[model samples]
Target: MELPVGGHPADKYQNPKTMKTRVIILLAIFLSAFALLPDRVIKGTVTDGSHTPIAGVNVSIQGGGSGTVTDRAGRFAIRVPNLARALVFKKTGYKSLTMPVTSDSVLNVALTQATLKTEELADQILDHSKQPGQAEKSLAFNRVAAAPATFSGAVMQMQVPTESYKPINENGFLSVGQQPVTTFSVDVDRAAYSNVRRFLNSGQMPPEDAVRIEEMINYFDYNYPQPAGEHPLAITTETTDSPWNPGLKLVHIGLQAKTVSTENLPASNLVFLIDVSGSMSDPNKLPLLKQAFKLLVDQLRAEDKISLVAYAGSAGLVLPPTAGSEKKVIKDALDKLEAGGSTAGGEGIELAYGLAKKHFLPKGNNRVILATDGDFNVGISNESELQKLIEEKRKAGIFLSVMGFGMGNYKDSHVETLADKGNGNYAYIDNIQEARKEFVQEFGGTLFTIAKDVKIQIEFNPAHVQAYRLIGYENRALRNDEFNDDQKDAGDMGSGHTVTAIYEIVPKGVQTSYIGTTEALKYQQNHVRATGDSDEMMTVKVRYKKPDSEKSILFDLPVKAATLAFEKCSENLRFASAVAEFGLLLRGSEYKGKATYADVIQRARAAFGKDEEGYRSEFVQLVKTAQSLDGSQETARK
Candidate 1:
């Protein structure tokens, strides 16, 4: 303090006391200036143009290097230094936004994804063409359209690629005299119904591959008798005139699993494996998924514990195992989730399985609830890879359940594969009401498995049935030898789940166009059934395993040659047949003979007994909507 660097000697000495006072004044001024420039906690959510939360967005005060990136929920809380007039939000694929900071505590921002100008897109395509093997990738971004676009007028509907489904090859009628037995796995999935409903509600016909008639019929609740004995399920069979083809008889086989009380349900260790990728930024995806999970949270018992794992570019555990009683804490974590980045679904699955394994509960319901649009692009994206991954994880005794969300780019084939291979059930959640139906009203059926590897084998009586064809389940048919193989995987049946399968059968003497005739085989002789079994239509054999067992138990039911008229059939049978007919019409099936929307409506209405829950009523209305969309006559063939 002898002499300041830039000060005179006289100035240093003459102001010993005065200089001290001046220094105090200067210190006070600096302290006051520092006090005026206080730090503020700026908190906000970053979303895209669709108002979907966007993660990994860079948020910072203007002219400041210090900033924070948004978490998976698109929320950020950063302390900003003084003299910052505005906040800038930046992300690579989105347009950078500089918003005025009117409030120190809160600022919600919406950013738009950066779309290339026509010229820019053209340049990118041109450049990509010069590079080897890049043409397809470039064209995917700028594909040819059916019509010229007026870009300034309205936003054109973008063509999002979807997984291709194999064409539906209708099951052919097998000769009862030649091949008396038909074996197939039971399918309890209801994705086809909800997905078809989505298309119809949007005034578009669903693709043929999307219309699984068996699933559509099974989607509705049938008042089938519950199991009265030791078996976990009850089987019932009924026959009536086929609504589409009157020449053939519709055989309805129903299996209803026994219901368990909520108190009796085992403690559940659930992992909510959610996809928070950019593709899930749509309202119907991540947002709807949140609401759906909230409903599920409400149904959780106090003993249940839940952990949440989110995946975007990579997977991360957003929340640790939280007691169901700490619902507020769980929901708060859920609320913080935001959608952005590429999808890494495979990583998410591995992480979810890891958590499920770590928290494995003996005799407890250990499961993972996967909610996604099925856009697994980043790591291990292909179906085979995913199936193998799930297959390996399934051996750990942890079950999985997939809830599909969103449209356009939905990967039904992928999600369906995961569910089928993972020993889980697949369902599509089209709306909040559907969510309530799955998570609240049918929670036990959707979450608790009572039977696994449920297979159905029917031995037709040659004396009664001339030929037979399963109406749907084209993808679920199993080889006769595989039906008894415990190692061969099949569909699972959940508690209180009702599965209905229909077969259009031709009586021994009846004539039909579906009958396939073949020359007599020289290598083998076909033995005709004796007349003593003339009254037996077929024998329904069901094989299933306990939830924890490897060996299967078998049950049998003998169906008679029922001649019940369509009008004389039970409401359950009639309604299920009507649904099958609707599916045929939707598919424009080759066998849809004399099927009209009017007839479908009439049959559905007549069978809409006890319209509790209004599900049947909704079906009737959906039929009317389809009628309006396709006209009075069936335009499905169009």
Candidate 2:
């Protein structure tokens, strides 16, 4: 018989050498299959270059059906098909990475941090034109993120109400009174320092009356740490001059609110304060609110309890406090709610608080979740009385969370105040996804309070800096004394919440100061503390009271490094800065420089981070809408 070279029946009858070759061939096949099986076991660790584990990173194989998120340790394991040649990794705040599978079944991958660039910021500002029915006089900005920096930047456009656009004061500050919306576009360069010092020293800008766009932007996203543990909160601030105008510079800051595990959250007591008034008869109003509530109902745990209250001319208990485990009962109550009569929001709130108080679970999550258009037309309609009632109820330890719905008559002012006074948070539910964000995705943080009365006080070293101004938080600004006052209630931060603020600084050696010294301050003798070290820029102090407590905790951090180059900041910080500038322009802020929509877009484009969700891209579209509205208004005026 002929000798076989590889595994064959003939090899049995062949010589010893042929038989040995046949055995080797069979062994090779078995080893290959074993090797393939090990590759099928996909494994990797999601981490930053700094060797820090990044949880919640999503991992999936290209063209494969299954995916998994990184665990608390930033480790992930998935069973992929043996045939798969590669896999992809992604996360919201981190860049997405795709890798080819190698012989080692175990893989260690480091994901680069996601950031926005200058051009990306610009693109976002220009893209805002796509918003529906954007008026010709609308104001808009572009937000972009950059690498290594934590915040984003914005480019803005101002639509001048009249042809004669001039600052009322010779100083940089714009007068608060009404001015014709002017169409002016300038790039707001990123600022290297914080603006808080400017506000404190100048006192030219009115407190409480002015609205900082950054605060409005940061307020809705409640990402405080969980009650169980400390969460890492990061913030970056930057400022640069307008690409179109050297005289103007924009300031931007980015904040990242880290989330803790939900394993230790306490059971919740949620009271639904629904508004089923005559105005809510539209399908999108009452019906949408009903649907939204149902979605929230689905997110509840078995240990959680819920109650229902409806208001129109009067308020009534639609459902008593019931266990979340009983879904059908809650759903039935929600289904039966009907809309009629004039809005009696005050009465509704009183009744809702009564129910919440009755069902209060000490040391547990107790909150009245109010859903309404914020229109109150019946008895006790005064905002002061309503504020007083909510403030008093807050003392009872029952928190308030407001969900704003509908337009045309939306009471942003009232809703904002109620949330602030009630030691809770507010959200605007324009769509189902937003509802999910507030109710489903961030359920624990939305309901529970890890920290309350959170406040930040940064004392800049006058030796290293000449002038500074806080970018936003115009309404939240506090006097140096307010920081120590436990009775003075500040902003309430929920679980896994992160708050960020920024300031623009004019270094001592800079040619000119954006903020001039006040007459009174100039006349007064100044005391200066000189530090020889140029590295120490400022000292940051953060103070907060634990939820349900009166005592405050304080933390101090020193900013020792000199100002970072404009290009060095991360994309997120750059993009966020653009957004701040745009917001300032929209509010007609006194500090707004030569910021414009086109400049905002260009900066956003350069710093556009890994925008998997397209939020940054959508912001660009909004800017375009604002620009079109501004142009049309100017033409009509002509």
Candidate 3:
């Protein structure tokens, strides 16, 4: 037979150099055939902060819309039009990179690893491990990380990569990769692990249920105080016996943050502090944020004035204080913003607050809306400095509202603190819909402050109730002393925003006990006490200061009999409880007992009252994704 036109399979396989040369020749010939045609080849390598190669990275040309993944050697190549301007590189667990495609085809990119706290790792381990007990152990280790250190004061840093790593023992040591092995350790007393195990076995997780209570109360759509006059703030409390732990009763408290509308509302002087940093170049960041603000701009009246300040490596006032009626001017200023340069967030806040004070509208809704990824690279990099700065600004009568955007390098803790100190609200905008929920749909409630330093304190009648736990306010809980302190600011409630809180209670004479009793009160008198016989269980107390007031007004609502039917309560309570349980699981709270995604979904589905916004349905999807992640983690753990 005649020799093959090209070459034998063995020849092509064995003589790889010759085969490569032949392929190159063919490609060159093909390009030469179309001499005038414009073509380009963009190639780059992706590496970690340490300059170590990271394989399987994704590289894409922005406008060209073509993409490829890097090989084992971290090299990626993509063919594009010669006029192709730039390319973007992205990978999980690392900051994305983007660069212009200049004459040099070879480009090297370094991606910074995202920071993860031990608590976050615990969440990941619980959600991603494949084994049954592994998640529980990882959760225990995380708790140990948070325990008070009995040894030296050195901070123990822990890193759990998105990719799975080997299991860590009680001593807190794990290895990953062959070349650069990573290790972690936490300060644990001799009996710490055993103590934690005992606590778990005793079913005594932290009083996390109390924490959730505050968040649930805060998350409701409460009616706010109108600018008209002082009115009686109303909150309704409904309770029922718990199904899981019959000894504990479930109480739902709903607060309506309402304000009577006055003929003349206070004039609002608002400053829009926007981040134009390079990291915010993503469509979801600056573009979506701009769109979200436009909705708010449309809701503004003639009494309102808005100023714009933008920062990226430098801070500048893009627009002078202008009347809300001048929509064109504001829109043009917003449209001119372009993302580039490093983030100078601290400077941006300073400039924005300065502008707000310059045009301060006393007795009005004076506020600075800070929208960013919470990434401050320039001066005042520490959270304390930023917090102090915000505190000082708040003294000038301008409140702060923090809107967090994007994903990588998101500083949730920092944003939350800033909002807390500035006497404002904090919200994360994950999509345009949430933006509408924050800005357009809830414009007045979002921008106007009805009540400030609002705190809830409920004293249960020990005779009627045995024990109680609040749900979902782990970070927001105020110390008992901080409750009455006027200077100690808490959360703000907006007009029309509802706040709901749940407390699980146990009735006296019940056979079960959720919490162990401290040796019965010593030396108490044995005087015969009359039993009221009323079904009343507890009295709820709420204290709040007017937006401009220093002292707080207290309100009380008494909850009497319990209801067993879940059908009587609004869907909001049931749906909120599901989310609360999900958060508890993510934190691996000691309180979680036999709670699963399945339970959450079932509860949510049953209580999913007219979900016109579809938030409840979306919650189901999130639960599913979390469940899948949990399954994967279990597998890995095994």
Candidate 4:
């Protein structure tokens, strides 16, 4: 019963025009104030009480719907209403934090570790165990739930770990007199490094099978020459003394693809195949997935196109092929996604591939990026069918890029197999920073393929090198005959990608006990040694096909013997040596001669040359952590 603004109580009762005018004036004032309350992007870093960055922390605007999670680097960027009062930062086993909203663009937060309750541990632990023929991977959800892990100031969880990793037997020495050729398919995937890091960070030693040394070595960028002529890749070689053993030589082979600037990169027609199953209900899986993809959406150009296909109990196209310029629309769809129901990943793949083909761009990037925890229950039955499907689709010129998320029930074998057969690469996104690295920082290298079916064959001169063993890549080994078969499938390299391989070699004159004498056959005399190529240690031959071509081109380089001391080797060799040595210790390889955590720490510190992203620095920290844990009495080495 109050009088209208600017009108007496009696006049308000007598004049309807005055009341209407007042109502319009008041509405204009309210709208003006509301329009002035624009959204602002807030950037920040979250850390624990120790000041170490904490990944996977949920950051949300209080009383607002917008939210995001911290990346591996503990950094996050979120858009919030200007009038928001506070932000809530939360992570399991950490005390929840709420800080008043401020005008500052950067907000740094630190949360203290909390004593975890049984329910908390039950909800937080990420474990997925698999046994052969048991279908543990596909049947993970149906089994009874496991117990919670013991907590100790959040240092390490005491629980039965269930992550799946295929058994990897370290390669041993091969006498050049018997086998003179070393061949392997090139592998550009780096998922192993991040996955292994996750294990260490969780205070557990990574299962030996999870350590793919070639993938680890290739994760970091090394300075190498670019392709000069018709080839899309350039080669570099280095040799030095092996750090683990005396008198043994180590050879480094590096391939660097030509760098194509963003402006010159081809238009992209992309399909985002996502998993929204009940297993992905974990915050790190589906929720983090949505945020991770938003980073890619932000990088899209007007010419690029994006489509989204989500699968759970079934598969459906959430967003049709739309221009990348419609970023808001794409991101809105991403934001609306929720996790529930069983996974029908196989059907999702078919739909995604079909869409990619339908919108396929000739002479451009046509790809399907699958985001999932690798739990495909309803759709794909076994890998044989999955591989056959992906392989067929890839032949249609639509490549796959797998972005693995979540932990429990993760089917790494399936992820790796899909990437391998589909002529693509795989990466595990443990946090938001890693997503940015994939979708923003290494945008070109993650999507655009420059070469396919890339393979390497090295002919060792027995006269100079007596024995050699490839440091890693047990799974990528190819039959010598397969190298020459153009129809054989191999790893594909992306633009600006680098692949490195190392070999531990024993010289002809070096009397190494590891290469025990092989008795000559009584019926067949040992083949005579060929010394014609004694001038060179090995001839490194490479074969690769263009993105659109079926025929592969051949190239070769004769590498002379290296005489540099281990300490005097190039930074590339030294760093690679450091990483390889670390892998050796992690895998507990029989060949980890004289390798110690101290040596790895020192060597990595010296080679932390151009770590612009702090990855090398993080490696050093992980090594130190492993050194600490492995030294604990409970984990004493034999």
Candidate 5:
């Protein structure tokens, strides 16, 4: 052992107290010197050798776990201990680089591409195929596995929408003899269509929950005969051979709300509840929201009124209840908006509802149009709380319409809950074209409610059908007992909007693993269909309340079991079926029997009647895009 720093070896032996004091002084001096060293932040951009931003690159201090991945912009900032000797940058498909930490804080790194091992390539393929919870171990491996991709030297990190979706449990075959009735709300919201489009356009399969077949089918216009009766909607049914599965029959139900002329529509009272959070700063978010709202503004009549409520870390009334006549003023207020601060969605909701109540308009089109990416971070951020808030406020007679924008960190579940509870409709705007479709082309259907608490119940006859399954609507299913309960809430139907629902039925004696049979009842006898009763396959019952009423009106339609050849079905039904098949394929659903892109394209093309709007053609193109992504060559169009 060496003598204490401040004393000689003889001093320690002669005087222990002097030696101890010298040691304490020396320790203090050493610590003070170390404390004086500068704490530094290393900030820089990571790129490929080609000088393009490389997102998702991992940057770390050597010998430490402290690290961060580059943002979508390929920028990163990390705090390093003063003693850190070097910084390391790494990513897949690129050479890992470690450099000494010099006096400079900014270190721009350009990584070279490198060849990956066979194991690495297999791991990447496996990672892509594994579902969220199923790949925990694989994901853990991937974190430490620095492999190369076939992609270019620099890959821009795409903004991933962290939208939550509950996996859809496809309706199971129910024994008509035991349980004949199936009931669900009539959902007209078209959010799923655009949401699915967003994923496919980005070259990814959509989350299963995002592919609601009914919504995708309803997203397009269907030519159904208008209602001439006292009812506000016309109910039509078409039965045909299942195009995807030869073993089953497809039942299509269509509901078309009565169209009211724009001039005849009621005066409007609107509240634009806009989110201006830091998350909305993306070009596709706040800026796009402004553009969309401007379109709605242009559609407003002189009799209409508008209110603007903006929220960030807090909520504020930006423009209070301005008349539609002052379009310039409303547009100016929207143009001046900027995105910053954390999201306070709950606060914003409360304030928006407060404003709507303060300027309550009876017998007018009173509604609140909420524009957001659904990032409710600051207050009442969870689904249940937001649902309760909307549920309570909906009783105030102001309907809500939710428009979701942007991608990253989107709270889809919260928005869905809010719309469902608030007597509203939800639509996701992925691009300006979708915005135009919602705000301009389908303005009335997007904003004006024609019927509330719309419910559909189907009672299948045991003699005609053995088992049946209602396609999609997993999240919208309601108890059979709740169908007639006027107090029970269901979905709303907007003016001129069309809703479609399909049921796959296994006729009596047909075999299917989708549903199982129960033993004969010992307690009760199965009812035998009398003479002509066997011809009726099912009875469809619809219950709906007028927009402002509490009592619901009931209507029934008897569907004959007669099955049409797939080729003989109406063009509308064929197209809708094609869309449903595509949705199933995207979801990777177990129920997607024989639903090939080729089949869907063929059916859609054949049914692409009167394509003046070019929507059907666009759909064909989208299907091709999805096919290419799925690694299939496009078959020649007939």
Candidate 6:
């Protein structure tokens, strides 16, 4: 190098060898700056063995010095140096794949989803595990609540990945004299229970709103008697001292829909409206959904007809009307679904409903089964808009069932609303077992509706009950007059389905601050045939319409005021109360009273009758896990 400059930094190097070293340092610095400017850009989509795009995948150059995450559509763009030799793609619960860099600018790669060994999964779920995080992420899913503040409170909610839940205000006691009539639509959705299990199993407490006490209690089966006559359902009631509050009385009301065997079921005209948006790339979402549909396919008979429609950037029909016997066609259509683009849920609904109408099945089950995380963003994604579309479809005699999958951006409020408006049911699938339960074991109850617009109205006798508070069903409450309105839409009861509701009542003479005294209500007793001297506590009235009927029928049952000790109550009451107590603890309700996780666990285990499929037993285990995570002690009222 020629040193001819004036007083300058580089001019200070006079020795030839030193000058060479200086030149080398300058070259290194120049290369470092150049490294920041990549020489090439590579783009590709990551997918699973089924050729479905995999979202949230980690894409990086070999050795991981630089990386980018795949977007909602499983597509990623990375800038790399010309010398970069290979790309590494990895995701949790999937076999990592590394591919050599080629001259091609676009390279699409597929990964093989790996199944963790049973030992590994079991070790993670059991109490005292060292890696609860790993098990939850690989199995169900792992999501932490959004932080409350940025760079401050535990969770910066606005900045973190978050799940959605409609906030709940716990129901409080109402004086029987002031408000004796309680009316509500029966809810059959079990999403809240499994979703709660997802949270507790991941070594974290579920957010309060996620705990719907009624859903938790209804998740298990109760031995309510089947209808003994021409009616489609039977109603039963029992009262016992509360497990959480001995001073209070727990009233259990159950309605069981008669079971219809598969052979006797009507033909179904099904429309599968799937959300193949990038957000659905999780293994638990799309892959698991495909598997669940296969189970439904396996149960299909010759009379059933099915259609498939999917939405991403836009909506389109993937499969036209085809007989359920053509399994390969449906499975192939499902297999080729690759998640990408924005969600056009509204468009998807319109198209699916159109198809359902085109192949209308009179006297058959016509339903649009919507599977999505409910992260609608593209067009008409608002809850009210979607509800409007479903409402319009409802008029056409098309029902909709919503299947919620995955988390972290899940629109739970939207899912529930769509199902409610469509006059159908909803379920959240956190794992394959739940999928099996929804699509296989409860096949009839999941798809075939036996009764619709089912509503319950109960009138408490002021003489026997001073005050009463209904547990859960806050969202399902209706105006007292809506009970007998045939035009009003309520809830649908599927074949072999059961619904339960609990009430905490304060007896007339015994009271310990549950419901503060009210003077006017005391003097104004419900005097219209109140049965002042009778043993009747409350009268249960049910109104419902046949699945395809336009009119409603009414029936009533009178429940006795006799109360049993918690120990003497039937297994149904004990187990359901245990679940309710657990919900109170999870929700931290003001009315939790003397509730404790320890009591819930003990009560649940004692009432774990037969547990043929081990669901109740699984519930006990989950309670144990929750107790461990909650740091609950053996004592009551933790």
Clashes of each: 4, 117, 43, 5, 2, 5
Report how far residue 49 has shifted in candidate 2, in Å.
43
Please give, for residues 531-593, the per-residue lDDT of candidate 4 as tens digits: 654678899999999999999999999999757877777778888889999999988898888
Top candidate (lDDT): 4
Could you tell me which 10 consecutive residues in candidate 1 have the lowest summed lDDT?
142-151
- 1-638 per-residue lDDT for model 5 (tens digits): 57776755655366878878989999999978987787779899987766766655678889985666664356788888777889898765577899899889898888887655545545544654353212322222211122222322222222232556666787777887678789999898888888876665444446666678888888889988888899999999999988888779999999999998887888888999999987788666887798889998999999898999999999999998888889999999999999888889889988998888888888888788899988788987877887877887777788889999866466677788789898999999876667888989998888888999999999888778888888888899999999989989899988898989989898888887777768765543536435235688999999999988899999999999898888998888999999989988877777788899899999999998997656676677567657754542112111
Model 4 regions lying over 4 Å from their true place? 1-162, 520-529, 633-638
lDDT of 2 by residue, 391-440 (tens): 88888888898877653344556676777788887776654544566677
Ranking by TM-score: 4, 6, 5, 1, 3, 2
Candidates in order have lDDT scores of 0.80, 0.60, 0.62, 0.82, 0.79, 0.80
In TM-score terms, candidate 3 sits at: 0.65
Note the residue pairs that clash in candidate 6.
72-278, 147-155, 147-156, 147-157, 148-155
Model 2 spans with C-alpha error above 4 angstroms: 1-212, 219-258, 511-513, 517-529, 532-534
Write the residue-wise lDDT of candidate 1 on 1-638 in tens digits: 56666765657367578888999999999978977987878898987666766655677778865666664356788787665678899764366799987655888889876543445434433653444222333222211211111122122222223434456788878887678799998888998998887766543456678788888988889899989998998999998877777778888999999989878999999999999988787667887899889999998888999999999999999999998888898999999999988899989999999999999988988899999988788988877987887888777789889999986668887788889998889999987778888999999989889999999999987777788889999999999999889999999988889999999888778887777676754543434524444687889999999998989999899888867878988999988988988988888788888998898889889998987777786687667657654552222223
Best by TM-score: 4
Q: Which ten residues in a row have the lowest lDDT in candidate 6?
A: 147-156
Work out the TM-score per prediction.
0.75, 0.64, 0.65, 0.83, 0.75, 0.76
